[model samples]
Target: MKSVVANYMISRKWLLLALVILLILLPFVLSDFRVNLLGRYLAFAILVIGLDLLWGYMGVLSLGHGIFFGLGAYIMGIHLKMEASSGGLPDFMMWSGMTELPWFWTVLQHPVIAILAGIIVPMIIAVILGFFTFRNRIQDVYFTILTQALVMVTVTLLISRQDVTGGTNGLTGFSTIFGFSLSDPATQRVIYYVTLGCLVIILLICSRLINSLFGKALIAIRDGENRLRFSGYDTSMFKVLVFTISAGIAGLAGMLFVMQVGIISPTQIGIIPSIEMILWVAIGGRGTLIGPVIGAILTNSAKTFFSESYPDIWLYFLGAVFVIVVIFLPGGLMSLGKKLKRRNSNEKGQTNSKADYSAS
Candidate 1:
């Protein structure tokens, strides 16, 4: 038994190592377009892992992550827009007959400040939302509903406030970033690697977080919040912290995504995107950190492929795939390995028992 367990662990290590190597070599092996697509998916992976931490471990499902993601993307997009404007108002603003930048937009004029706000703004929003909701002990379905509602409200506001937010079009027309032309293929490849590096960093942080006592508390709250509270732990605080951290991570993903995608629109942050984010976590096997990453990549890749090949039916195809995964594999894709291992172990045990019976 010990030998078998040891071998399994070793195999897992080798598998992980191979995956890392594959990711590192992908840019070299694939076309620039494919590499960019994978890079965008990597950004989604970051978002889903954070969602897993919140919904999978902490037992809080938030459909409003799209808002935090949009906040970060918009913040970064605003910076790029400002730079593109070059000491003048953005094209959208000028077209709308605005003579000056909004005060909020002005705050993100500096690249460094924009980056900071890209991350920090989502966290601040999370803290405010988490504090109020968790403090009131409003969780589970109510929390989920509120998050979904927030997405609606946020998208509506952004669309309605066209002069400030670029309306339904969101923010685009980014020419350069940090003096590097975005249209340059070399610059794009560099961005792709940077995104991959960020994904690694976020994974490490989440892995460390889950292995710590805080992670245990999160699982505990997920399993039995009232019992944890009865034991004198501040469950609300734990919930709030996890939610805030996850929001910040989502924000970081947004910034990376905007760097590659070149657009941040209200349509992207609307209800459909929020639901898709949740599906990534669910289909990936939420509690397992790596599962969500895999889920995000696979699902988004499928979306890209289908949208390219079968644009008219891609949405239906994606929906059908998720439905199948949920109905048949509720434990998710990660659980398949465990199931197979368990079946093998059971077969071995039965064979041993039959041999003993014959000997008797």
Candidate 2:
């Protein structure tokens, strides 16, 4: 049974099931601090899985995913700010001496609108970015550069628009979410469960997508976009669709993240964060759905552990991890088991051949 599971065979579905069960039970066993941290990591896992669909299956890398994530977070954060302020302008705005609420904030005052907009606004922006880039036949590293540029623009806007966005300080001081006190442990647990549900549902849908024809087209695009285009499929449209979807998924992850972290700042939405997100998918094994999820969680866990002790050099530690993974585990951590199993199988085959010759 051990070897069977170790072989990465079909029977390992039960192992996945067991892992999910463990995740579901975690909140009950762990303290609120640890559970909240897990919730944040799971939110990141959702974002990376979406990224895997793009970079892993569709053959395009985006470094501006933080923009979409930030949009969702800021939308949610703005709404919470309004709620905390009880229909008046947020404290930051008062500090900036603004007389009234901004036009955008006024519209998102309703909870339903805020939630829907949090998810949809990111998709809309993604659609625009996707259409402009993919339709123009801009490919590869150029597309990546555009995304990073988008990050720069976004971070700059958030910082410069101090009154509206809270500038470098970002948005915080949330008393309630939909009239429920955020300070309540029970409410926090509910948020955790909601985050977990989103992660699971997103993964399941992505898994289904990978098994569908659309997914096949994505893989084909990744392998050879021109060859697939020659086969009469609209390669650019497929890229746009996948990129848009990935952005929307990242936006959703950001929404969940803001709820747990209770702050959304320019720092979180900058170029560095987006690059770290890509590293999660790369280090996790991009081609597979499960790999990026594992990579995001593990990498974030390591970051938390290391950053607490050595805040200044933690980034260097992250760079070292990427280097090690690239050199020794090109397929990311997930492939390590498969590599070992294959080596052992080859050795066993050699032993069997020698025994057959001896018997002869």
Model 1 has an lDDT value of 0.86
Q: lDDT per residue, candidate 2, 273-298, as tens digits?
A: 99999889878887778889888988
lDDT of 1 by residue, 60-99 (tens): 8899999999999999999999888875799888889899
| Model 1 poorest 10 in a row by lDDT | 351-360
In order, candidate lDDTs are 0.86, 0.86
lDDT of 1 at 121: 95
lDDT at position 299, candidate 2: 90
TM-score of 2: 0.93
After superposing candidate 1 on the true structure, give the runs of residues whose Cα lies further than 4 Å from its correct spot: 1-13, 347-360
